[model samples]
Target: MDESYFVGWGTLMLINAVLAQGKNRSGLNWFLLSLLLGPVATFFLALSEKK
Candidate 1:
């Protein structure tokens, strides 16, 4: 319920989107998933192989 919380969440989402793109994944889809799954999504994205 604080500004820093939202800022951190948004930052994580952006990082996840970038990571997903690097793995040949959908940035928008991963961005939305990151909103829900946070670091779990990041872990999966990190483990995904490039196309």
Candidate 2:
């Protein structure tokens, strides 16, 4: 049960990294931020200006 949750979180982190790269943002930074903010990070990423 707990394992699945972490797996999902890790998956989101990877996806966020990809998305961040597409937006010309730092994937490592966004991945770390997503570790803390989770879905909120994705939301902010969506609202952020793309390069």
Question: Which pairs of residues clash in candidate 1, taking residues 3 or more apart in a chain or in different chains?
Answer: none
Give the alpha carbon lDDT tens digit for every residue of 2-51 in model 2.
89999999999999999999999999999999999999999999899998
- Model 2: what TM-score? 0.93
Best by the TM-score measure: 2
Q: After superposition, how far is residue 7 of candidate 2 from its true place, in Å?
A: 0.4
Relative to the unseen true structure, what is the C-alpha lDDT of residue 19 in candidate 1, on a scale of 0 to 100? 83
Q: lDDT: which candidate is best? A: 2
Candidate 2: give the clashing pairs.
none
Supply every candidate's count of residue pairs whose N, Cα or C atoms clash at under 3 angstroms.
Answer: 0, 0
TM-scores of all predicted structures: 0.89, 0.93
